[model samples]
Target chain A: MQNNWEKLNQELFTSSKRVIILSHRSPDGDSVGSSFGLYHFLKKFNHHVQVITPDPVPPFIHWIPEFETAINYEKQKDESFDAIRAADIIFCLDFNTPSRMGNMEFAFDRRSKDAYVINIDHHQQPDNFAHFQISDTSASSTAQLIFDFIIKTKGKTALDAQIAQCLYAGILTDTGSFRFSSTSPHTHRVVADLLETGIDVNAIYQKIYDNYSQDRIKLLGFALKDKLKLYPEYHTAIIDLSEKELNSFQFQKGDTEGIVNFPLSISWVKMSVLLTQKDGIVKMSFRSKGNFSVNELARNHFNGGGHENASGGMSTLSMQETLKQLESILPDYKQKLDESKI
Target chain B: MQNNWEKLNQELFTSSKRVIILSHRSPDGDSVGSSFGLYHFLKKFNHHVQVITPDPVPPFIHWIPEFETAINYEKQKDESFDAIRAADIIFCLDFNTPSRMGNMEFAFDRRSKDAYVINIDHHQQPDNFAHFQISDTSASSTAQLIFDFIIKTKGKTALDAQIAQCLYAGILTDTGSFRFSSTSPHTHRVVADLLETGIDVNAIYQKIYDNYSQDRIKLLGFALKDKLKLYPEYHTAIIDLSEKELNSFQFQKGDTEGIVNFPLSISWVKMSVLLTQKDGIVKMSFRSKGNFSVNELARNHFNGGGHENASGGMSTLSMQETLKQLESILPDYKQKLDESKI
Candidate 1:
């Protein structure tokens, strides 16, 4: 299996140039991270490499290597889409389908006619547009596959501080600093490999995880104090932020990033949601514990599907209307939770 | 040194009936942690144990084992002082002189006249009040000494989950999760031993460090956004909070905890200060990098002394006056920082 992966990687690298790596919309730590990690790897081999995302990198994502280089097509009106059109190979990472790319789907489709699209992702299934799809759902992050690629195909000596830092960021954020259930001994081995780079792990941790703006923290405080809504019997938690409240707090693009995770801390709360108004659309994030599949719930009810533990969607309806829909379905989830004794 | 400490601890444990374990005034993570660690240890031996503090346990100190049981003499008006007066042993941990005990000095002096006072602390210098003093300034925390006592005297087999949790808290906070300069191989060994008890390491980390109330975070936001005052040329950062702001934010004891460390991230800043109003006393905390000794700076300038990197003190002047003083002395420290080229 390992030899086959190396052969495939070698073939892909040899035959391709002007490689573009892409991740999902609203790129998170994993998607942005894995995409950038691959971007750097291709750059090392003198390939004309670029990483493009649908949305701007979030503030928390700023700590990752070469984040400033990630061009958001929406922001760069002058960006030559010619790079994508001229590319020989386009690598799509951390996502399965073109629709998951949001507005980037058009560019991806247009470029695929000229270039062989290689899907190197850690998600279920693959888009039919890809000629070579290396989708491993069992892998925690696409970066992990890239790490194996660097070691097995390239060489362990190829792993530099920059690459190690990028990989570490992906592994650390995705595993919640090795606290999440997804973490395994393989994750520790990856971390141990990164630590061998002598990257001053403490400073990196302080910079990435510990550092936070007082205003963002205050915004969180205000949400919890006045806006948090909890349904104890239903074991559900909800937090809402209107555009006016966000504006008043001078909210940055990524200010509400991890607010959804806070609610799940309540021992009884099996699921959590954070509803916010962004660009005139009501954005809702769903998170769950145990076997409660937020992706299934969001995809079936709202127009969204993600991992089993987390999912997100946008609604044309007002938050009030969304709450009514949620209220109707919450009782069924509560019953399921009770039956599972969670 | 080992034989003497072991003999003293053994004698105290065997003869003492009602023992009082006292931490420092304005108890912090290490002080309260060591106090509670020893409290739980003595309780396991079926000794009558009462943990005492001069003031209330600071909010950040809740990570200590059985911290809820710590008695605040300042808050308890109805409780008899006679209970302390009749104790066979008084174990003073994490403090040296009675002057540092604040209001508890009167009670401590009265109780120790007939009792065996064993001072088990991790501080510089000592007074002649105690019959036995195990004050090793080299130790990261008194809990480190307590762990040593447990291994050499109580035996390694005596360690259990609760005791391990307490000891882990002490070592973790004092060493900044094994990132600080004081962190040694012995600290790692202590952590390894704690893990042997099957205590969930991640759970303890989440409970202590990850547990953040939104309100406190908001207060932090307000401080950074509005309260931050910096001498950019001096590479000195200061955040001064007024009593009115504290009251409006509903500031508790630990509201500004770890707030001082944020400013040091800016590459230019060599030192930082967090000044807040506590009972009208200008409470100032200092943090520094490299060889800049905040302990000496705090002691000489602000009536505070602590480790080389971190320290605190109280000022008789108002918060505004204190800020003024800090600004006046800025140029000297600025020159020092420049000389260090840090």
Candidate 2:
């Protein structure tokens, strides 16, 4: 994986450059963490760095250092595009293809002919978009790649608490607090190095996980109590919240996040779904355990596709209709769901 | 910490010895992990090692290698005491003091006079029970200390996948899968080294965490939905399950193990409690965040004491009266609970 990455230090980084870091749409922890982590590291080299995201990051990660500085393209298009157009070196992080950049794709294609692109991601597959790339699917998160990148180039001394905090957040969330299957020995070692930089581990965890409001948690309680539905025969569970239910909790954006994962905790549950009715549409989330392939399920029936275990979709129907539609489609996948393992 | 521990290798372990490992009563992941971990490691040196516990391990950990070899004092008292009396060296793990052994204390005091008691623990205020001891309060778990002890004595090659699995389970549970504040950089590094021994991280995690029965999760769901009561004014939450409620779900031992901790995930909840009624007794569990000291609350109000953040108690009164008594005492702790930080 190291290959010719030494050129980053020997060539590009030796000179001050206009650098813009681009991450995927609806930036998650890895997207925000890797982008900002690299942005923070590049600044020490006298480069003008801008972290441009396809959309605003979740409220849970707002405590991240300089998170406010990230340009959300959906919210701040002009600023994001300007940074993209003027880039000397574009670091596309966390995501593999420019299409993953959402609205930021055109800016990269039409305006950044003079820029050198570097792709550092842990996802599968790669296109010929980057002048330099490191695609390691075995890596737990892109933050780990950034850690290796810095250690490979400048060694461990280059990392400070700020750099370590962002990277750790990326790894921590992406690896589900180190519970996910992707977490490897190297992942823990990377976190060990990050902890050595004196990052407040508990503070970071609380800021990301426990930062929800009382109403948000209450909504969760009501949702689990009243909304969560089980299809035990199909090894499936669903939580469908109507607009009226959301309003009862004074719902805010991102409040219902992670609510979908609760059902997956059940040992026999192969698939879990969360549907929320809002703005005349029912947004859908699908998560599964083992090889049930929620992606194929979402893509085939719900007009969406994601990874095998997690996916997303939307419904232009009422919450009841969506729930009915979801229930109607489960029997076809019942055999596969039953065969899936946790 | 490594003061004169060379004697462990140069003198004590120079030849095979009859070694017996003991852990605390109602053995948790740490107790079982540390004891079995040392048991596995010591056996590699041709030592006749037996792991004797005060009770059977939780069902989740039964997958651990040779877990069937474990001698449970509650069920097999003769076997446990025979092993305890025949010991040339005693490795006291997880718990700090002899009193932690519960019914086995008298046996240790009366029968093991010639045994070289080696106390390896991570708890606070260990008594002067061992001739050779390592009581490190800062360590993530006794398993981590054992990792250090083994590495310090016999080097890394002394470890195998079985030993690593046991130790990792210890650290995984005691540190709440590395989420607790006690986890340090060294903890991760120890896990990293354990993983390097070719341990199946996912398999271990699934066996320990995902091994729950469907009924257990359903019980949890019902508890959250029908039982969880929030008292935001005092930053408290309680879930009390009556005998009828438990009967509805066919409650099993360890089913409610982590149910008390769910409310602590709420941002403002400084303390959470779980009460279970069975056989005319109301068993109480108290868990708190920051420094509110559930230990003192359990001790002074409920006739039980444990760590400051987590404790246990019992109520001979009816579940209703016990809950009423619990709620009435909250006003006195309102300020302290509010002041406690997460």
Candidate 3:
């Protein structure tokens, strides 16, 4: 499996002159980290490398080295499109499908005819968009895959503190700080190698987890106290937020990002769901422990699908109606939830 | 240093019959991790090893392997006393001074005449209590020292997953996940070695961080919203919680463990202070960024001292009076605080 990736990477880079790296929309730690990790690694070669994000990198991840250099397609459409047009090889990182690119999907599709597209991701069921596809669902994060890519192609000597810090942040956030089930011993070994590069793990943790606004934490408090709901019989928990409640806290794009996972902390909760009303649609996020399979639930009920333990969905109905839709279907999974307990 | 420690460890273990490991009162991650790491390492030899704590382990840290076996002096006094009395070798794992052992200090002192006490700690200015002292302030945690101790004596092949998990937890928590200044390149190297043991780093992190109660998070919200005070001129942030507020939240012993470190997340804040009134005395915690010395502030003004960035202090004055005291000294340290910023 690694030999194939190594051959493809070598063949693609040997003759390639200009390279543009792109991550999915609403760039997260993994997206930003993997893009920059590849960008920094490829910079050591005799080629020009550029990183472009679908949108601006979030403030929490702003401390990453050279993060400001990543061109935001949302803000600078002309420059991002120019880079996409002129690229010889384009690296699509962290996302599986072109539709996940949001507004950049058109540009990617238009330029794919001329550029050699390389899809590198950990998500399941990647689309057949790239000429060379390196996808592994078992990998903890895309950054981990990138680490293996670097080691396979350039060897361990190519790793430096800057690359290590970026990859570490990616793995740390995607594995939920090494707590997620996707994390394997190989993931830890990869992290160990990254640490050897003199990256400060704690500073990266602070930059990712602790750089939140005061109002966001306060919103978390309100969500837990006033919004959280528990269904012990079904081994499930839920937090539903209306547009007004979010506005009161002045909700930003990523304010409620990980709030859904908080309920999964309870010992008995096998599944959790978060429903937020925004932009005339009720956005839904589902998370589960063990083998409850939130992906199936999200796909069947709410027009979205992701990994087994975590998934996303959306509803065109009102917040009340969407919650009613959720309550209606939870009982069907009672047996599954009970069996998920280890 | 390695040779001396190896000799001391070999001499101490070879002739010893019963080994008892003791950590300081109000045991934390470092305390529990170091004690248990040593306990598991020594159990491999032809000797009986036991671990004891001055009080109950916090609920957040109770998921560690064999955690329930550690005798708590506060709850099981007779068993702890008997263990101390019968032991021929006592390992002082985390604390520097015997006074830090709380009520168990008497038993330690009484048994010191017959048993050989080996102190392995990573604190500044260790007391002259142990016959064989292995103290390095540069080490991230006592657990890190124990990792070195194992490598020095038995070689790296002797390390297993259980010991690695315990020591990794120790290093992870002590360095605040590797953000603290005490975290050096050597710390990362030690963690790398531990990770090579195939321990589940994510599971350990989940067990430690995601086990907090609902009230504790709510209390944090209240502390940030109602009690937090910012002195922008002095680059100081304070959280003053009265007894009533704590009672309303039904504060547990370790509820406020990391609350003081929250204000330091602000880009401009250089110093953070948490004052919580309990019984008659007001307990205080001081945290600073960069070169600011909280130890000096704690030692000179509040009758307490710890590491440079983190320190503890106490006051006999009323909560109102303590606020006045803090306010009065704000101007005196303006020059120092200004110069401390990196």
Candidate 4:
């Protein structure tokens, strides 16, 4: 089944042409990892390759090799625009739709019209923007898909420590260090193959999980202690942090990234929500255990959607109003929440 | 070099015999993982196996397969004692000396005079009590050695998902989720092989890392917020949790396990000290980065020794006195600490 995509990707990579790899805005481990992993692989063929993200990579993930070289469209718009325009091939990674490209969508849409745009993602409902698409929703991470792409196009020998480290970091973080249900036996096998490349897994783990600042830890403490609210009857937990609270902590871009999943740690709690006021709107992240569909809930009520168990949404209303809206919707999910409980 | 031990292990395992696995007191992931890993491997051969820990396995690690079957010597003394007495072979895991077995050492010493004792561990300075020893301090975890032992004794085909999960958990936790220097490429290869057994890596990671209680996270919040103190000149950070503070959170045995390492995340910090008031004494944990030797400092000043980067100590003084004593000793280490800076 993948042979068709392999053939296309192989044909695309045959010559050393200018290439630009673009990951979605607010690039995560998967986005950065897949871009860099493919970048290193493509660089081997003497291609003029440049990796660009819609925004900056988080400090925790800065330890990835060649991370500093990736252009941030948010900071250096002109250079990023030029790279997108000059590229012969553009690898759009980790995201599906053009809307996910954020402010860079305009440039990407204009420049990539003539270039051979290839979409390699694990997200559901991929848009038909790419000329070549290799989307598998079951993949643990897009990094895993990139690994497969590398193995199929260039063979397994092409995976060096740098490439392996990037892919491993992608898979490790995206799968929550391999706890998510999306992780399969094949994921482990790929990890094993990557490990054989002599990449330091421990070093990478520290760079990702243990590189937090004192302020971040303190902010987490404050969030868990003061902001968390629980409604045990609905098996729901929410932690809401206002912009003022974030400013007090001097919050960076990725500081509150994993805070949404913390509430799901409670044995009784099946649904966890994190509502953080960012810019003019409140951004909401939804996480749940078992079969309760946070995707449907987010899409129907909050104008957003993602994976079945995990999803994102936004609210234009005030924090109080959003809280009221969330409270009102709990009754509709009572039976689903109760059934999903351990 | 492992070939000799493998031969001896194979000879010992030729016949179906009663096997009792003994781990050190206050059983950690490595201790429990190795014990259970070997238990499952031997069970495949129809051997009568019972694992006994001096105390209860911590709740976070309770999800390991067949964990409930492992007897706790502190709670089920009679059964544990009888198992030791009836054993034909004793597998001592993750401990250097018999004293580490706590009260169970007396029973082990009495019963093991006739039974074959095999020491499989990664700790430094292992005592020469075992008839056969496969002690390698370079190994990331004792569970890694157990995986080698299984492959050598029964071949790689003996590895199943259950055994692989146990071994993987040990390596994951012991290596601080593959962030420690002890995690060599070989350690990763072993992990890769384990993953190939169809063990769910994500599920195992969740069972080990994500199973924290609300009280534990809250305790962590308090420790970081109110308890943390820094000695900038010495590049030292300390977090002291008092008995009252612990009681407020209803702290369990392993609640404060990794709190010491949190301070080490600071880029400029060279050493981290965790002082917790327990029983009548103030228990201390020391951690350092680079060439600094926390083990030497703990041994000479705090009456404890362990690894080079990580070690444990204890002080019989009050919290105030202990803090003062620690402060007084910082001057002596100032030169070494400054020299060790990255």
Candidate 5:
């Protein structure tokens, strides 16, 4: 990517610069991971680097090294503005356009005219918004891309345990712990290289994925115990949670994020659906394992569309009515669902 | 491991031999995956290979290539015996000693003379029974060992999707989907190489891991809902099921096998225990992550022991009493348990 390595190295990486490492708003594992992984690597090059985020790092990601030091534009506007004013180079990671920064876009627009922005992302179709970009939609995560960047620039010797753990966290979460189709052979190889740095893979996995709230776990238990209904013949499962029941568990916004995918662990379940009712509307989350496209199901029925395996929909009907409608529609897709899991 | 490559090539691998691939009793993912992976590889050399298990490859393993073709020593004694007798080279896989064959030890004992046995396993303290042995307890799984073996002998070109899937299944299961500490960097590298063969990793993962019975899932729900108790201060959780509760779920032996490990998924939980009262006694399963040693705990208090992370015990006390005792003992170990998960 560096056609003029000497010039870019001298200007961007060689000499000490006030580099601001920036990620998308509402930062996730990949964004935080890629940002700090690059941040740590840059620190080795004697760069005065400061990682900045649009929001605070969630508790699940607090285990990452120096995560608290990352300047939050929303939380510390004056400091973030000061950091932006002092920056010589800015890194746009895990997101394409500056619009992905949401309310933090103003912070980016305030960067000095001389500030050089290098984009590193895996999301498809980046906006024409950076001085240099390394975009590969095929990459499992931006963390993996950042790994390649470090190896290409400074070679494998530059990676240390801290950088490895951050990257490992990124790839592990984004790739669904190496279970998703996005996890390519190179992803595993990158993980192998990362593991060789003496990062505890098990610990990284635990820190990223295992930080569940007690109430959230209890809600999961209740959902599985009382609401889950399985249809063996149709190879389908549905779990419906009412607003009342959710309140009983003190449900928050993201409590049901993964509940729909859980039933996919059942061998016969080709398609799993979770319907959560709040504010008189039922929201549906669909997850399929093998070949059944929840995207198609969501588009053809409900006014929603997303990925092939995971999709979302909404119904104005009651949860019971929604379940009834879904059950009635199952027989039509039974043939595909029967073949989906195999 | 092959000191005399030329000799081994001529005598063991190059020439067509009636190759009998044998694994230990009660075939698991590692045993079946290793045996059949080697089975497919040996076929390239024109060796007529018959994979034999001590019993039927369980329903869970039916997805592996030629798993059904694997002669079951228990179900088809004559076929197994005949295969053993006709063998010119016996590949002992996934087991250290012949005694692990259980009742099928006779089958091994009856093998024809001049049948050179090469033992390939990862288990510790392999018996001095085979002419050649590659036992590395450090290997994550026999599947990983087999991958190394394949690469050593035939080079990367020898691996195909079938062989890759088989070995992938072995490593995936043995390493607990790459979460267990046994999963080394080399293990991930081996998987990377396997994935290079264009195997459908997602499908393989689904086939091997998603095959759960409906009753088993329901039982898991019941346990989590009605039996589980959490001690956040001690970083511990426990689930206990009485005989009546077990009966209500139509309990099977392995239904509760991994129940103790579930609580460890919560980030703060260092130790998790499952106490199931069946027949006349309460059986205890203890699992802890990070530094805590459940083996010592089990051995000290419950007269049982196993590995550092997972162990077992038995109690004459009622489920309630066992829970009380465990809760009381946890306070004494709170300091360690608090530090255990990190």
Candidate 6:
């Protein structure tokens, strides 16, 4: 018996049918785009494929075609859950831990006994539960890895506009439009490959980047005018968006996107904070420069920890409590900041 | 009688007891950063140097130390003008046209007859009026060229911390924090060189990108949420900010920066517009994708032009009139967009 991925990929053109894809909770661009991009590739083979996510995708990301057909597990209690049980192969994207899978963890666990699980992720320390574990930390996103996987598995040289569009979204959002440190030469080559498909790069860029609501713009204006706080001495800046203010702006789910970067502009300000309200809970995202260690801050102070420079934490406390907690630790990093002045 | 730039550069090093450096109108990152970077470099030689700009440098750009000393031409009147006239050398950076020199254009024209003028710019079609034109359009910004010029003139192999900070700003702003298409390998090498000087790249990124006013964020929110309009058939998206709304948000200058890309996220939208009110004039910036010609739109339609994909224009009409004009031409591009769909 050959490996599950090798056997499936080898015979995909012949008999592989009825595939289903699932991404981790809070499906980021990489997971969403990768799963959908693969869905598009499989569609050409006349395979019936459905993309499922535990929660609703971000509003700004509604532009993806795969998102239209995505099965909401919470909403479609019977169909989406039943569809997973019937699928031959379950492709899991961008998750290494079951806890990160949100509500789908139970369904995935139940389906593992019968269906094949093909794990594709870029995160560190993946669980040893999948039939096929193809993970690369050096890769910018799971979408990039999926692009290569599609090429190698199918042995196809042709890529259509839909395929190109999804791949572009995957590469773009993952790399922060290609400015993040993870962007490598291979990433550029992948982009070049996608571009060769004659998918309008500008169209893709515009659709994925430009659409915004007037209310969101108004909310950002309110934040900059009234909510931003700066600490020049400690080289720190914070922006607090109260729940009332968010509601007044007709707060859409994804309106807080890119709001955190604004506070990071003050001269000598190294640590920036964005505290926003979501469902009576405060979500604080910390962005830092140099050795400020945002992950450590989130881990020690809040109910979260992520990458070193960019990370997030959650708190049941009010916006004031979150700010108060952050300010308490400001003194600890002051001397380190002064010694490393550029 | 070597031409003025050679004469002035020589004098600036040899006999210059004092000097004041200034950039053109609407001082961008390259011009401001280059001027201040050079100011810091000359300070080590005990030369009295001040960085001046015709426009008020926005608070977001306060990271540069010399921003504190940038004398606004309008406020200083005769005193600062006299100092500039008395200087042995004037390094006019990043502006090839005289109009771009703003209120100080007349002063530069008058005093530069005797004083030396070294035109360091990255823009194409340099004005023949400059005595010394070390202009390279291929370079990312005038700051990178200035970095090269500094190494060549000073005969030094290494850049100091102040110089590194200044150079980094030029690179950061001009490249849209390294996300713009202009970022090249040479640009990366210059960044690496700056990093070698022990400048905190993270801190620089934080100050330039992460810092924001709550008002600005609120303004951005308003622009994206309410003002953005997308025309899918014509592959066009527009974010129109009126004077009334700007005032309502307590909008300061530089609030709409990077707000243009927000509306481009709608799939199939190839061209994006950012229209706003500035000094009672309506300004329009056009960004496009694929073969969409925003430069042509700006030139033939809006009395301005730029590169094929990214361009800008201006109009005296109110926001309503500008929309009417855009609607008139938008239908014409529909056919071309439809043809490119294949």
Top candidate on TM-score is: 2
- Backbone clash total for model 3 is 4
- Give lDDT tens digits, candidate 2, residues A140-181: 999999999999888899999999999999999999889787
Error of 6 at A26 (Å): 1.0
DockQ values of all predictions:
0.09, 0.53, 0.32, 0.41, 0.62, 0.18
Clashing pairs in 1: A214-B221, A218-B218
Once fitted onto the true fold, the runs of candidate 3 whose alpha carbons sit more than 4 angstroms away are A1-16, A112-114, A266-268, B1-16, B74-82, B112-114, B181-199
On DockQ, the stronger of 2 and 3 is 2
Pick the winner on lDDT between candidates 2 and 3. Answer: 2
The whole-model lDDT of each prediction reads 0.73, 0.86, 0.84, 0.85, 0.85, 0.75
lDDT digits (tens) for residues B1-342 of candidate 1: 223665566656665478888777777777777887788888877788998888777555575667777778788733526556878888888888888888777787778466878887777787666877777777867788889878867798888888887887787677676555455445556665766776665566656664455456556656665666667687777888888888887777666777888677555567888988878888888988666888888988888898787898889998878888888887777667776533
Ranking by lDDT: 2, 5, 4, 3, 6, 1
Q: Which parts of model 4 are misplaced by more than 4 Å?
A: A1-14, A112-114, B1-14, B76-79, B184-186, B192-198
lDDT of 1 by residue, A174-285 (tens): 7665455454435545655665665555555555654445456557656765677878787787888888889888888877878888666555667889989977788889
Write model 5 residue lDDT over A179-292, tens digit each, in one string. 888899899999999999888877777776677677777788787878889988988899999999999988877777788877877877889999998999999999887779
Instruction: Sort every candidate by TM-score, greatest first.
Output: 2, 4, 3, 5, 1, 6
Q: Candidate 2's error at A47, in angstroms?
A: 2.6
Q: How well is each residue in B77-133 modelled by candidate 4, as lDDT tens digits?
A: 888888898888898999989999999998897794568788999988888888788
Query: In candidate 4, how many Å is residue B314 off?
Result: 1.6
Native contacts matched by each model: 0.02, 0.56, 0.23, 0.39, 0.62, 0.28
Worst 10 residues of 6 chain A by lDDT: A1-10
lDDT of 6: 0.75
Per-residue lDDT of A67 in model 5: 82
TM-score of each: 0.67, 0.93, 0.90, 0.91, 0.89, 0.64
Worst 10 residues of 2 chain B by lDDT: B1-10
Better of 1 and 6 by TM-score: 1
Interface RMSD after interface superposition, model 6: 5.9
Question: What's the CA error at residue A62 for candidate 4, in Å?
Answer: 3.1
